[model samples]
Target chain A: MSHVNGLPKKSPDMNGNVTITDCGDSALVAKAVGLDAEAAWRLVHALADALDAVRLTGGHDVVPTYDALLVEFDCTSTDHATVRSVLAHEAARLGPHPEPITPPRHFVVPVVYGGEYGPDLPEVAAQLGLSEGEVVELHSGSDLTVRCLGAPAGAPMTDGPPFPKPVPRLASPRTRVDPGSVAAAGRQAVICPMPSPGGWPLLGRTPVRILDLHSDPITAYQPGDTFRFRPITPQQWDEYADLSLADLVDSAGLANSADLVDHHG
Target chain B: MADTLTIRTAGIVTVQDLGRVGRSRYGLPANGAADQHSARVANVLCGNDERAPLLEITALDFACVPSSDILIAVTGAPADVTVEGGVRPQWEPVPVRAGETVKVSGIRQGLRVYLAVLGSFEADRLQGSCAPDTILGFGPALSTGDELVLRTACPPLDHPFSRIPLFRLKAPVPPFPTSWTIDVTDGPDRAEFGDTGRRLFDAPFTVTPRSNHIGLRLQGEVPRRVTKGEVLSRGVPIGAVEVPAGDELLVLHRGRGVTAGYPVLAVVTATGLSALGQVRPGQTISFRHRTLDQAVAAHRAQRNAIDALRSRVRTAFDALRIRAPAGT
Candidate 1:
């Protein structure tokens, strides 16, 4: 109930811009209405900064998705009112524009293209009216930044590379997609770190284990991290099966890592 | 001393603790015991810390054999716990000699059973938690013949009052009800459904057998559903009542993903999570609407009550010179 920028605290219903609503008793979601996903993403960072300034930080507790930010806290300690107040106060404090939260790290995962590594690769190439090699050229050709980490546990979802057209998903999702299966749907490409059900079209598979319980650095990539795929042969894929994310990043060489992008579109 | 417990039979078994908190940003769900209160009760009765590693056995036959003398507590869905072929009580500590076979089966009234050993239970850890995340293939699932090593064996039970376990003297167990009417709060997308989402509380929804720790899929009147690819992907909560574009209404549990794309119309309150976790498949569940403030108050009350029970148990253990770390 302390003063926030000399304004009396507003209830959950009074937030001007952000639609701050209760996700549950323990979590709150502030989604920016009438804003594009990018603008919403910026608002998420602003709210995160606003929360951090007030000593509310649990690095992993604040989940910033494509547009909205879901903030979770212990209901026993931090009540719902305080969280909403902070969001409204910060929104009022910083009017108009907020800076983007760009991911600072980059990783190039070695993947085996086509065949069993990704069953949809051939069809993806055929549907796009491009040759198989051209498909690989288009798929592994761009540096895609992660939109967010979601669902299948640490699978990084990113905007798809410049395929001639927005790639289509399967008519019905497969019951299971093998772990390390790299998939594409519409304009997004993602890596399925575990065997789970999915409808995305598979382009290839990465031998580099992105997320593992027993390994150090369980999940190396975060939102905004630059994620790129480097096509490797089936043998190279086999070699990468046991390697960790650290191993791939280290071997890819940090200096030349920035040169991996071609902007094929 | 590296003593181990061998899993004799595994039926949907895993190891869990309080769960990995604040790790959702890394795309990890705070996967833990489906029923948090029962897990803590089991650990408290066994003279171990609430966050100590323990076994989470779902509805199915589960048995284990200890390699050393240890005290264990079995709590959750009422179950027949047999130590060395003899029945042992649930919700209190029971001692088992080295090489004794402990069996937990016929789990009735609930879905999960917690088995907490008296000392430090060891397992491969991630983010300082031993809880398994099956969706991510994160922790080892308990398999028959899998040996679970205990870093600290049970303390010598030769104290003057060792004739009777001191920790067993005080264990406050709350009611475990078969009929459930869980409390839920309006979610961010509740306005999207408006009148349609009211069907969630219209009647009792049957928990379909398709349910698991990932989510409790209920077969009921489907509200105006949001197609799978409709909403932007966002982080979902432990007890989120997600409305998918399907015949079933899904209520997410602890084992759910950190982020999902389905639109959530309402979220079950924390006060209702334990009951949601313990209900058996095919059981009817109804939702009661509560304001966010009321929901928070109920959570604090439940937590405060658990803290009181923990302190009392710790005091009794101290009388026997037994160490029970303060519950956080």
Candidate 2:
């Protein structure tokens, strides 16, 4: 088989591979061919990076999702054909296998499970045929990767390893889910960075402020980050509650205090 | 700086500009003026930058008292504009004296209206946009007793009310068709619906009350999809007509989330999206398929029309020795 950059070049017949298509007059979509979460993430990152390089010349934005990367450009200045050509050139440079521009960051998020913080915990556990404690163990014990930030600003969709049985979304969506609520739907887990209506089943609430508008880097988790839930007591949740973005960053130790300087500075 | 405008009866008003561009990657929706055409027109009438922040008022009544002499224009939904009890024409630039209360009510058509001043509104901005994204909890919604501050000082102009030229153009008037015919093109998931996708053009859909800036939920037969598997969540552009399992057609709008899981049957063309923005609840809508080239041409034409109008306004301003704000 022909190989480029140590990764096998996707054949046309491959069930789940990347294919580029026109999304609209000013946008193009590169969709991941299959249902595999890992493959989807890899393709999304690869295409997003390729498009980012292309955007150096012209392009408004490139949004990466679980299974696709949407590239938007100014139609008046650059046409879809030009963007496609740029993508093709970038693909040649990537050579099938492309390394992530930045190494994945890891986070340990402390979550308070059950009770008011997690209103749907018992229901989700019952549907999964597991005890409430077992449900918590299953969710927190597994390491998950940040698929992408979506649904709302700073809301991170994390891909958990396949569950023993498929989990379903809530038939009736709640009008509001509290901010910092940890929720699960199907095979994916998500952190509600803001209070918004959604169909995902609430599993817990984290004290971490994932979507801090006051912060320099508005979100806590970025794509390609690894995270695991650490069960915390309600008291611990209270202790961490009301912490500012600067405080959270300090606790995470990911960025230096100097990096927390305001935009005006 | 110019004195702030005091809100006397603040309806559902929020500051909006051209929207936050290039922030979809951070899961931020492009929340801007629901009707960009009207917003741009209002700004042009006021001699402000096209993307300057303006008040987006919903169906409810809005009343404000200016603290300084200001030039203003109201566009979008047809509404009665009364300046100190004197009726002023909608979609035309009108000058108001300081302390004169301007009341906008009796909306005849459309759902929202744009109110633009001669200069941009001073407000907290996120991602270079003043538009409020309630989901993200950024930017404030205008309320009774709130004050609206302007970015620039406005010195009273010495122009007579009779001499202020009204640059009239063929703009769409509302009592917006009870039934709307919108144009659309194939979406990324168009093939997922197979032959059933053709049904989209055959029937009319009613806009349900359970709709907001996020999307318009249509009451109609859900176009059937042959692919029975879960669609991975992906980026959804504005004007994407998605069909969830509930058998309702949901057309994403300006405030749509960054990503969605429903299968998108078609994407409304740029002109179609502007038309969709004016649709009121209980309105009936039908879709017509257009080729990609046709959609592009229509978008270009609409943009060119706006540019021509802007040029005319600029020429009028130059002739009258009126100073307009710089480019957006």
Candidate 3:
């Protein structure tokens, strides 16, 4: 492993450490090794900010995941060696250990739990040896941080405090999980942005449209954003479901009134 | 009003360009033509921009009738093109007169074919690209009787065959080996597989029928992993060769999902990726290890060759007094 400036290079197996590796001729993957949910969030955000600082230097893309960031560059314009050296220089500038200074953006996402919207709620409760109401309380109670945006367009994979017992994946994946279905597997929680085949246990369905093609930013949730599910009735879901992109932008606290006009127009 | 081309027999036809870049961060897949090399060649042959919208036809049995004169070229899979019962060769520009029906059939040796027209196709653009994302329902797929509107009008040529000599330049076609051997470099998770990773190049693997634009699933000997645990889901590149729990090898293609959970043992080179695009089901393929420097060199060489072909096409057009369609 190459050292980042004067900082000591940590091995891949070391916990809470960051390591960089060559993915191919055009990309490099910098992974935060063995980090928990909170640490992963910090590292991902820090790495994303650092990569953004050097955005103009021919880095085509910077994708932040659960605990890693993949930086892709055009080999014709900028070679791998230049990208590596730039990243190293940035790492050194940020110092050996960088802290997340920006406060995480927060949101109160409304969800309708159980019934037709979530068929696997009762089964998930039974598996965890808890009442149906208890499952809902535990699921919606904790603050979840968006660890990554993936699996599909605008899909947010969030991580929260672990439940008393780990939630297991379904034996057979469903043919299609409805869009906005909130599901949990093991300790990870994810909101299905679009209808897709999924294996996770459904806990509820959110009314917020996470992905809107017409929207300027497209995705509502970014990495490091925190959200907690607020239980709403099925009637409320119907009301919010009819909300337009402008209304969603208002409710999600995405932009100010001035920017809303531009997005709406 | 712009002239339109109506599809008579459509078989999995969709519009594709160079794809939406810098959008993967939003979990969007970088969807484009499956065989980019062939697509570029087709565009060059018809004198369109390299990233112009074109049709990517799979298992092609496609026929289209133009309302007016148009310049068209078909590349990849070596298909037979006929314009009004007259044979037209592949990899060369062919001009069809008004109300002429062009039929393409007998696609052999490969799976997909790229058809490029003179001007850009008037299609819906999502994120500044015409490439269809089948999973996301972003663009329209061609069907029988559907008219493909052209952005620019093509007036009838007094002598359509006059420019045939100008397009006689030989296009450099990439070799599609009968028994394919793809070149790959080490992936991020190579260390996790240890000796099993080295064994990936030892035997040939068969492409399974389950493969599609998403990925090329291959049946091969499962590589043993020294570590057994889930790595955090991360961004996966286009040519990543991921090995999931089932021991099957999946080479992610142009329409690959933005992220994957499987351990990636290797990544196919850019040239190897275009070659992978031509591989049909049931075909056997083997992997050959290549260094990063070598992969870079090979990619540069392929780009240089394409550049050379572009210049030759330009020279021919200039000499023949045939102006390429504007904004190409």
- Please tell me which predicted candidate would have the highest DockQ against the true structure: 1
Model 1 C-alpha lDDT per residue in residues A1-265, reported as the tens digit of each score: 4434443323345465577767888888877766666566667757765776676532237777777778888788776666677777787676545754432467888888889988998889888999989988877887787777787787888877888777876877787999889988776789998898787889888887777566544777766567678988897766777887655553443454444222210
| lDDT by candidate, in order shown | 0.77, 0.76, 0.76
Fnat of candidate 2 is 0.62
Which 10-residue window in model 1 chain B sums to the lowest lDDT? B158-167
Using TM-score as the yardstick, the better of models 1 and 3 is 3
Per-residue lDDT of candidate 2, residues A145-201 (tens digit)? 788888867588888534577567788889888988999877788888888988888
Off by over 4 Å in 3: A1-17, A33-40, A49-58, A96-105, A122-129, A165-172, A233-237, A244-265, B153-166, B325-328
The TM-score each candidate achieves on chain A is 0.76, 0.80, 0.77
Q: Per-residue error at B304 for model 2, in Å?
A: 0.5
CAPRI class of candidate 2? medium
Highest lDDT against the true fold, candidate: 1
lDDT of model 2 at residue A167? Answer: 69
lDDT of 2 by residue, B52-157 (tens): 9898888899999988878788988878889899888787777778898999997655788888888766778887888889898787788899988865545555
Model 1 C-alpha lDDT per residue in residues B1-328, reported as the tens digit of each score:
5799889999988888979876676777888898888898888776677888888999899999988878788888888999888777888778788888999999988888999988757777787788888776668677898998875566555345544433444455555666788999987777677678899889889999889888998988878753333455778888888766468888999888878766788888887898788988878888999988789898888778768777776676677666664333
Q: Count the backbone clashes (under 3 Å) in each candidate.
A: 1, 2, 0
Count clashing pairs, candidate 2. Answer: 2
Error of 3 at A247 (Å): 4.1
Model 2: residue A90 alpha-carbon error in angstroms: 2.0
